[model samples]
Target: MTRPRIVIGNWKMNPLTPAAATTLATAVAREAGRVVRVGVAPPALFIPVVAEVLRETRVGIYAQDVSAEEKGAFTGQIAATMLTSYVNGTLVGHSEARRYLGDDDERVAKKLIQVLRAGLEAVLCIGEREDEFDAGATEDVLAAQLGAPLHALSESDRDGRMTERFVIAYEPVWAIGTGRPATGEHATAATKTIRRVLEEDGGIDGDAIPILYGGSVTASGAIEFAKAEGIDGALVGGASLKAEEFAGIVRAFA
Candidate 1:
């Protein structure tokens, strides 16, 4: 099966105010019909407002992150179920989540389980650090991140009920927000690694998974990555803030 091409804009606490977020969300939602799968992850505070607006639009709403715990005394932690009604999915293991928030692969694994259990999609992020990439530890790191975590999910696959709802975004840590040059080639390699691990190690249908390339993705980058073999889409960062820019990227798939 040919996986659907997607573009996910992760609006990580930007535009300064709720009103500004509504404006951007509206802009994106207006043009979201251009792509088969397009989503935006706004700050949690604006989720309700944007969700209400985008509910009728073709665009999908995604949470930037979610708590691994189903429920607890963990103050300030948002559970997976909390976002189900609002968003089509949630993003986990983002570089920022792992860096500033200290979300390791184990934590990401738990978060994915929770997202899946709640019947929501998980846009799981996995990547290699600058040094790790230089040392050719990319595949190893991806295997550890994608392999051991979903081992238990293979049982669901055997039941023939688990459609490919999950997505993988491979972001090289060094390239994100640094304006580093990376797109087609880098994403091709990363997607191959991700697919191999999912099919060979995880015993899941790798070909059915939609793997995207993130880290400094621009409109032009989206055009390139979309054409590259094995690259299904893009997980845009700063470029996603602008409606015209993100729309151009969304149209790249078409």
Candidate 2:
């Protein structure tokens, strides 16, 4: 199968204003092309501005997170269906949301279902914490996370048939923002495990899926991670706030 070169800038909660976010998004869109696919998930409030700015460009506008509800009385939750006009995709289940917001696999799975239900794509993050890794339960942890949330999908999606609207991010919680990135081998291995679980448990074609590396992905580290075997691209953090630096990461595969 052909490798998917996709780099996503997950801006998280940064950049003081929508105009500032627009500036960064425009800069990244300047580098988009046919080589590698690039997208950005600015804060929810900024998606509209960013989406409009990058409309003619290859860069896609994404939401940092979306609600599982289609439409509901759930206050403060942005439903996936509600975001169709704003973004092309979303980054669901990032470690921060799992940790600080108490979103477990079941909740993430529901969120993923909501995303796909709305005809949007998703970058699902999964990884072991530092303790789980140290305890040699990496694969075990992954299996649980990947397996649980997937139950929310119909058999087709679980079998990996939804390649276009989905991506898996192998984000080791320990690596994110710690300034300690995973080595090429480590990232590749984690993605291999991700692919294996999908292939074995879901009958998905390994090559048909794109597994990305996330965490403290710097411009320098982007080179190896982008080209590393089994690692399709990245879900960038702080560095995504910098226009030139984030564009360089996009060019790592481009």
Candidate 3:
């Protein structure tokens, strides 16, 4: 089967109020159903308001992050199980979480397991930093970052079909939020490395998993990135906050 095209808006810490989030979600719901799959991740606190607006639409609700720990006294952590009631899926190992929250590969692996077991799709984010790219170690960095999580996959989870729930978003840290998205050539190459590791190292069907290009994606460049070799869709950030602009991107991909 061919990989399905998808676009997910990560409204990370934006709008600053529940009323704003509800309005954004309502706007997004209006633009839904044109794309194969469209999702939005509001801040954890605003998930309910967004979910209420998107209730019957084709658009899905996602969590910006999830806890590696199942449950306990982990202050400020939202367990995967807890999110199952509110969201269809969750973003794991995002660049922000890695850089600011200190979610390394091991923790990411555990969180991936938690998400899967909780019956939620997991968007596994992996990429290299600017320094790593400057050092010509992009491929190596990508492979290493993916290693722990893939190895953490159970034998049953590697059965091809089950692996479909896992999507990869290659967001080069330097490119994110910098207005300098990776070129089509650069993204294609990076995704190639990601696919190689998924198939060769993880013993899974790489083509079955959708790999997305994230970081500073905008309407003007959406189609180019969407049509790039090996890219299935986008994991949008800043540009997603605006309804019209985000709709333009969805139309581009559609």
Candidate 4:
């Protein structure tokens, strides 16, 4: 069966102290049973510590990113296996990684495979740039991004085993941390398209894949977006930094 909706907080680069982690954990524990599933992706330095805090709570801890390689001399890279050992989960193909760190489709595909091998769920992100959106290439871009990696999955990888342990986040690159979000209608349309692509290309059922919206998501915006046609949940940014605000977004899904 398909998993329930998920609300994920991407605590990107903020909260530099243990005190901040404690506050967020307390808030998540307070609202534990309210939502279907809630997760927080803290900086790598805090993954293990946060994992411990949320262990008794319903909230899951996720790594911001993971390397496709199992192990290497590659300095400064955290492998998926290491993430599974440290964090409760991992996010792959975030836009920032694609834009700044140069993670391409092939890299993302490899990371997804590694995440699966490591026995940790992976969150795959896909979105279009501002120029692509203006050029009406939103659907095309999403299809290409999602299709490439999925199409690369081997027959052994499709044995119904590896396919079920992942989620997809549709984070419009134009809207990320920019204070502007894609309209509810636009978000819905994009998610629907993503679902269709999964079904058509990956042989994944539309109902089985959890498609999330990410990009300037807030507590106030959660209800409207959650009410959207195909949005399974959200990958929140700035709003997620605050415990109260992030908890509010989780409650919106409830």
Candidate with the greatest TM-score versus the true structure: 3
TM-score of 2: 0.95
TM-score per candidate, chains pooled: 0.95, 0.95, 0.96, 0.94
Task: Give a tens-digit lDDT track for model 4, residues 163-206.
Answer: 56779999989987676668889998998899899889988776
Best by lDDT: 3
Please identify which of the two predictions, 3 or 4, would achieve the higher lDDT against the true structure.
Answer: 3
Residue 142, model 1: lDDT of 90
Off by over 4 Å in 1: 152-154, 157-159
lDDT per residue (tens digit) for residues 1-254 in model 3: 68888899999999799999999999988876665689999999999888888888899899999999999999999999999889999999999999999999999999998998888999999989989988999999999999888898888766655575789999988887665667988999998899899888898878788988897889998888877989888899998999888887888777
Which 10 residues in a row give candidate 3 its minimum summed lDDT?
156-165
The Cα error of candidate 3 at residue 101, in Å, is 0.7
Off by over 4 Å in 2: 156-161
Check candidate 4 and list the clashing pairs.
none
Over the stretch 79-108, how does candidate 2's per-residue lDDT look in tens digits? 998899888889889899999999898899
Q: TM-score of model 4 relative to the true fold?
A: 0.94
Model 4 ranges with Cα > 4 A deviation: 1-3
Task: Name the candidate, 2 or 4, with the larger lDDT value.
Answer: 4
Global lDDT of each candidate: 0.85, 0.83, 0.89, 0.84
Report model 3's TM-score to 2 decimal places. 0.96
Q: Which stretches of candidate 3 lie over 4 Å from their true place?
A: none
| Candidates 1 and 3 compared by TM-score, better number | 3
